[model samples]
Target chain A: MAEAVDVAGLVDRARDGEPRAVARLISLVERGSTALPEVAAALAPHTGNALVVGITGAPGVGKSTSTNALVRAYRAEGKRVAVIAVDPSSPFSGGALLGDRVRMGDHATDPGVFIRSMATRGHLGGLSWATPQALRVLDAVGFDVVLVETVGVGQSEVEVVALADTTLVLLAPGMGDGIQAAKAGILEIADVFVVNKADRDGADQTARDLKYMISLGRRDRSGPSWRAPVVKTVAARAEGLDRVVAAIDEHRAWMTEHGELAGRRLRRAAAEIEAIAVERVRTRFPAADELAARVVEGELDPFTAAEKLISGSLGE
Target chain B: MAEAVDVAGLVDRARDGEPRAVARLISLVERGSTALPEVAAALAPHTGNALVVGITGAPGVGKSTSTNALVRAYRAEGKRVAVIAVDPSSPFSGGALLGDRVRMGDHATDPGVFIRSMATRGHLGGLSWATPQALRVLDAVGFDVVLVETVGVGQSEVEVVALADTTLVLLAPGMGDGIQAAKAGILEIADVFVVNKADRDGADQTARDLKYMISLGRRDRSGPSWRAPVVKTVAARAEGLDRVVAAIDEHRAWMTEHGELAGRRLRRAAAEIEAIAVERVRTRFPAADELAARVVEGELDPFTAAEKLISGSLGE
Candidate 1:
């Protein structure tokens, strides 16, 4: 059995901006602690004050660099910032690449800035599922802004959008034009597009393509549609980051005004609740192994098997 | 009411290798139709005969070309083959890239080959959830080989491994080295590594890097270790494909001999059954919306809210 930490004490210290306390609280969330109800109660009073921003893009698009730039931008505005990078690397290696990228120049000494790279390899579907709660920890711990960075590879990237006030989709030249971006399903999730590595030769072309794609994909035109603005940035040099921040702020304001923020949070929380409940139900399904054998042997079809498993576990 | 398709008649036609029947059965699976129970009952007896090979990689890795080559290879051996490509493109767009790639000139006329590109963007988490059932339909329809291809952007790609007897992880010369491949979470799922477009520069380097990375990431040393062999292939030109086929066959034989095939199938069935049951539970949780509001308002902790919602729904 894992040792029981003092949830109340941890939350109090975390609220007072103690790094150790904050880290411990986040670890509880990361580990999906059995004491989550107490921890959630302890932290509930302090959340909903921070702005959560999600930064995501395909590999080689400099997502980490953009996140570092965004963090600096938020810090420059005199706001405490926390970074939670969802790394795809294995737990065995601790992901050297993500680590190096997240620990940007001179970030270690900054008391106002906190960075945590959560390993996604700990369990299947672990990091993304854990991230929303971990964000709550940082929010309750007095961070003015929490930046969530994810490698845009999977369903986790989609999940990140539901948890954020603003989602920035990053793309570079030759990764694909805006049409290719649309094909990859990034078009729907992006509140703003960042054409990172804008100093490259095809930067203007990429921007134009994105703008065109955005126009074509504008889902609603009856009301004031949130046009996903494309911002060009040479993130490696920290150029054009101001506009990216500006776009995020604009999107955040729009979401707030249109009540989309509340809707997104409600949906995210509901999804989280459902996920936890389903996991609990799954734990009782020891008979699933035998049921699976029946399906495999053609003794029963999958639906009847599934119905039995659910009824057996949920007592329905 | 979807005008009821004759479930038994479709099964009979599908077993007789009628393309239209196979296509309609797969569509029912892809759509998560109300008739799925009937479909499963009809198709259950015909499954467990086909070999499922999952081909996955990062986008632009020539996965389609490789799949086409594999299909042809299977055809040359007088085996019927089916290609199910989980395309990321939205259904509104009809996935031109996936379509053009899958059409494979002259092979379109060959009824021996069945090609279906499942649109991943139809619904959130749709393709992965639908794939196993679709595989069941194809397997039952008397195909000797089924090549399941995915762009591998997320958790869905990981889910594919549960259904496949052998998983081929594709990489190219310029798309990072083996360490980069491991970072993308492909190392664990890969049964074989194919360096496609191998005529390009750094092909040898990519192969060497993968071999080195595999040696480093060897998770088990006690039992008969399945070392993922790196093969070079210019798939577009159909070069080095014989070696690829040989590797896949060898892996398939090894899995069957080890009883791993039965174990994998049972686990896959259990997972599919679990996913279905969870979805059923989710559909009953209307109180989740109210609970979400309380969590967002900080009036109730999320964990507490989840417990209440689950108990209310499941009568726990």
Candidate 2:
């Protein structure tokens, strides 16, 4: 662990667009370092510039292939690309979980590309605590686009939408992933739908199912409802990727026009801040450990235990 | 909210095999009622008699249909049964999610059957926070078997294993769910594996995949190794259902001889009690809202904000 004041030099290098510095900063966040406050403060000015995109779906959904294709398209437009792949199962950047990123080796030599795979060391914070700070590191390091890929439809993955200007939910044909999309409430979280492996037998039906499920979703009536367009693609072949990128751009444009781009960032920042605050308060609650024992012994109940914990944890 | 004394009466009736009392008690647990301590005290003696089984897998895996089948099997053995279906997507129980449970109408008129569909009510507790207490309510009311089911393979769903005496992970062929099971760390969480829709093409291959994956998991070195037996079942047709039940019985017998079942229950009780205490403590933390504002403003980093929140909230 570095001293709080010492992290500023690392932050300076990170902001100056040094890949090693950027990697070092993200590593600190992943490890839940004590000097995190220093890092966040130093990098604060450099964030809020990059376009953050989140890609998530069930495993084996060609999310990696789609991400690779999308990265190529973005780089063709001369954009600096950074990808943060969050795999909760892997505590470290183990080899097996990140086979796709290995396939992403095509981007390795390109100075315009930076990729980092993160596993949360199996902590309680999971994605909510680690990801935002990692995104901040990417944002601060001057990437034009930061792409996030997460697996599963759990609430943690859904929170990935908060960090993105647009969220691409990848599905495939013949796997019942479309019905999965509905059951996981992916219909509500997706900003754009990408049906990968579209050359398969039931691709059309999968697309139709997603469209129908999206129709049944409770629309956001705050303004004109943006219908999530379902697009089919053969990501392994890089076919239909141009259409996917076009959808991303159009969604980004819509976000800009409707002021949703700013709104998303604001909410993301707010959630990150709240998560941090609640976590910090957690340790200070007096008798939490003691009350827990009492509850286990049947001497107290949990809700009342919580109420007492709050009172004892708080100062006048 | 019922009065504390009134809840005692409800607990008594609940113990006396009253359905309305059982329903009211569970409702209180689900609503996170304030009289939780009183309820816990009353129900404490009646628990520890029920066996909890957690059924989890990805969506479209025929979990609910299979649960229905398993319930009928247990009821045939003259066992009273209760089901807790944990679906985070349904904020309120409505639509496609709970539809299968309704289809379990074969046991609808059985006086010995009780069923609950829980959707987390969009709370921070996720699955770990709610299910244990609900299990207690059912346990108090004298259900010999309490079956818990959860969707998806996210880490949260994996935590459901801690609450069950035996955790049954369901998978089907052709959905890529076998690979999904490996990816979501389901290989390690499953105590008994049910290959539902086993009559479908590639069911044999799917079973082979699970067997291979389980063999690959790092064996628990603390005791005699338990090899999670993979059982193929056409659950809808009720074929091979007896084999699945036999596997569960064998596992329970092994747990009993090894003292693992008691250990599992002790840990479950500890966790439920601790969660209640922590949840109660959360509300009393001082100036959490204030610190969250400072974090959003970038005036304070989350780590420092948490440190401050704890210090401010803690009493002398």
Interface RMSD of each: 3.2, 4.6
Per-residue lDDT of candidate 2, residues A1-316 (tens digit): 4555468788888767787888888878887787777888777756677888899988788888788888998998999999887766667547534664585589867877888877754753778888889988888778999999886667757778877889998888876756677888788888999999999999999999888888778454565777899999998898998888889889989988988876676667656765775565355454456665554555555555555554463221
Quality of candidate 1's docking, in CAPRI categories?
Answer: acceptable
Task: Report the number of the highest-DockQ candidate.
Answer: 1
Candidate 1 wrong stretches, greater than 4 Å: A1-35, A38-261, A313-316, B1-3, B56-69, B72-77, B95-111, B150-159, B169-190, B193-220, B229-244, B281-287, B297-301, B304-316
True contacts kept of each: 0.65, 0.31
Question: Model 1, range B197-261, lDDT digits (tens) per residue?
Answer: 99999999999999998998885567886888899999989998889889998998888888988
The count of residue-pair clashes in candidate 2 stands at 7
- lDDT of residue A21 for candidate 1: 88
When just chain B is superposed on the true chain B, each candidate scores a TM-score of: 0.88, 0.86
Per-residue lDDT for A126 in model 2? Answer: 70
